[model samples]
Target: MTIYILLLLIAMQLIGVYFFQNLEDRFYENFRDNLEKQAGILQEVIKDKMTPGTESEKQRKAIDDILNKLPLDKKNTIQIVDQESVVIATTSGENSRIGQKNKSPRVSRVLQGIESPSVEVSHKAGNRYMVYSYPIKNDGDIIGAVYIEAPMQEMYDTIRTVSKILIKITAAAMVGTSLLGIILARTITNPVKEITEQATVMAEGDFNRKVTVKSDDEIGKLASAFNHLAQHLRDALSQNEEEKGRLQSVLANMSDGVIATDRKGKVIVSNRRARKMLGKDIELNEDINQVLPLANPISFPLTEERESFLELNRDEDETLILKLTFTPVLRASREAVGLILVLQDVTEEEKLDRQRKEFVANVSHELRTPLTTIKSYLEALDEGGAMEEPELASRFLRVTRQEAERMTRLIHDLLQLSKLDSEKVRFHKQPLRLEELLEDAADRFSFQCRQKDIAFSLSIRKPLPRVYADRDQIDRVLDNLLSNAVKYTPEGQSVSLSAHRRSDGYVEVVVSDKGIGIPKKDLDRIFERFYRVDKARSRSMGGTGLGLAIAREIVQAHGGTIRMDSRYGEGTTVRFTLPPCEPEVNPA
Candidate 1:
């Protein structure tokens, strides 16, 4: 309040100064204007009388009469000089200056054809005067000039009196304003000071203290609001604690790892899952870059991206692939406060997704090859010349029929695989002679082996156990293995099928062949659908790549296990085992 009063006083003082200065300037301007008007009139009257080279007493008397008859003030003087610098006329008692070289510089300047005004002190009277001078022309020649002087003492005295009165008024206003401001400050500042003290206590975490209300005005309302704010702060802190507990519970049970960091990338919160996934317990306020595997340090003042993702593949005891999702924590104003990182293990998912893409691509390539061949052959037959030649047309028809058959086989294999994948295939399990199934597969492939001139052999160990298995499905598995053995074996190379009883009371069947073997790198994916060691050779021999995959599925369904071992450029061996049927005990 005091400061405001001081500012008001300063403003009043500035206004007083402005008005005083303006009044002084106006008085001087009016005085100069009056002198100019009088000078102009004098020039008109005397220009004809101011003749060059003329010194006449009658001319001087005529100018004096003209000056005396004018309505001039008592403190004003007017004089006229001729071209010879001799004063020709004067008003009242100034006739002593006539017929003399009136050598005033201002008057001489006017004689040279310039009109101007100036203020100077009168040495004799000790008072300031306004002096104006102008040229008088006769026949376009400056034959003489006129000079006028007016006293400024009266105008100065008036301005001085106005300034003293204005100063008195300004001083009185400042005194009155200061007294009122002090009274007002007593009412407002005391309440405000108390409220400020209460606020300071609140800042120190003491919300129990409240401001005392002494009046029912705005200050009283402010005190009431401060008390309400303290209550609200207490409630908010309690609710915040409850929410914090719930968040901790959720983080503890979450499957994915959760981590939170402040704006500087310092860890503020972490869960057990996050610690386990990172393989180290992260401490609070630790730099996030030190915890996560990063090729470059995370830059500060993080970018305003919506979110980000990172894939981390760490090869420690085993290959571990994690998908990390980063999201910024923001305030209501969309200001970033921190960061949230969620880690998910995606190793199996990535592997399965890759396999699915490969499966689709392989299917498209396989079907397109057969369909393209069929289309070409059919188009050839449709051309006029090809059908007219009987032999060529027969060959085209045969090739088309063969490709159609291949497509049919591919479709059938795909359906069989689908059923196996869904667990919809029912196995008619029974105890059967496993040796007889092996023998039948060898005999079925004997004709193909004879055509290829590959040696085929079968051996059944003595005391071979009867196994519990499916007849048709087991036959299918055996047929697939024997066909692959014979197909890959060179002419004169031997292919053998053997069945024996294992020490673990299971029947084992072994299919061995001296064939072009699988490479070591591809051995792991041998049982995957449509995975072939040699795609062109397999397609040419009418071999669907699903053979080995389907064979493995069938064997597993019959309570058995199947595996294969091969060395590049050497022989290959495929083996399987079926759980034997428990011996039937005699009924008690």
Candidate 2:
């Protein structure tokens, strides 16, 4: 900007100097031309009197008269010369070079008619002069020459003064131009500087600053665009951050584990669940193939698709059944940018489904057996077996009734279990003395215990906690437990039912027996419907296999827990708790 200003100032000064110089030169030229015209008028006045027959006095008188009458100023020294090249008259008065021979070469040329009257500057008497000579003619014949000398010192002095004024103006103009140019340059440079700083800040990832718009010009528009661009970048960054947060939130909260990888199969994103479900050592920004043991997980999909499930045995106790869904996240150009792997844990669902299938088969088998038995007996009765042996026929009829009863009990228990599973069983909850309930349940099962030669006993601790529960449901739970104890116990073995106050605000009922103890491995599944340690013995003893299952559901519905503890070759204990009713507060 400074350079441009300076150049502009110099050019303006140069033009001023050139124009003023021409004006000065032209002024001097007009001054010389005026002098030549005055010289020609003086020669014309005397040329007619200077005929070859005329005397010098007559021609000189005419020249003096004409010079006096004409407007030729005294700045020029006018003199008249004859063809003899001698001065005849002068404007300098009589004492000024009268009857003197002219010594100028240009005056001699005009006398010889070798040149026209012309003007030239000469320095004489310490002053510069414009000397002009013209030929005096009469009747188309040259007679004498007239000479004029104009002093140019004063004109040059005036011209120098004018040039000085012009120079001053030009200098002022140049200085003004420089100052104005600097201001204009700042208009461009200052905004540019600001924009540069702002751009630098933007490079550092800050788009919050804006350039100051000081004008409505192109530069101002540029600043506006820059600010807009900065805002756009900020919005884009914010949007990206929001999207990243949303993606991470979704990944974290997803029930299924998720892993995303780059085009190179490098794990770019993973969640805690993914790490836990895949393996504890799974790390991000590592090769997916290396981090997780996969057979061919890196076979990236050419398009959006789903693959088969991949099952991983995470540990001895848990198997992670993951349905690995492979999908390609493509760009607008239809190029696969990366791969997404969805890991859905199906361990529990699969286990329940498998259990359901087993339960169906077990129920079918249980139902088929009794039906088969009844069918065989009825067929026998219809085949005239009653006529062959009355005792045998009576026995067959008893067997049929027993099988039918078993079938009815199985069906009833199955219906009860279905209601329990669906949570459709309504309860009539009320406070009841748990010890009294225990005594009643024990008495009901006492006869059966005696028939099996199993000793039945009840242990009730003092101040036994009263439980809030459905009476009918609880009585059934007690019946099932006592029946199992009596049927499974060896002959003369003791089965005890105990009620006590547990510290956790509940009444605990423990039905324990020195019976055929369950295997240790089967304890985990003891409450599952239709699961029995010894199925043959259980069926023979009229065990429907849904007793413990029903007991668990009823106890749990009352906000309690039922647990079974058993050891192979040792006694088994099935204990359950019922929440006690809240104590009533008397009004103060």
Clashing residue pairs in candidate 2, if any? none
Per-residue lDDT for 1-588 in model 1, tens only? 767986997799789878988998899888887877887888887776656455687777777878888888768777788876788887758778787788778787767755444344454478787776777877878877777767788889989898888788778878887877786676578778888998898889777887787778888898888889988997897789889999999999899999899999999999999998877889999998898876566676564543334455455335667777777888898877888888887778988999999998888888999999999888888875799999999999999999999999998988888899999888888888877777778888888899999888889986676777889999989889998998888898888898887777777899999988889878888999998999889878898799999999998887789999998878899999888777534211
TM-score of each: 0.53, 0.74
lDDT of each: 0.82, 0.82
lDDT of 1 at 318: 58
Q: Model 1 segments beyond 4 Å from truth?
A: 1-255, 269-286, 293-309, 312-320, 328-337, 583-588
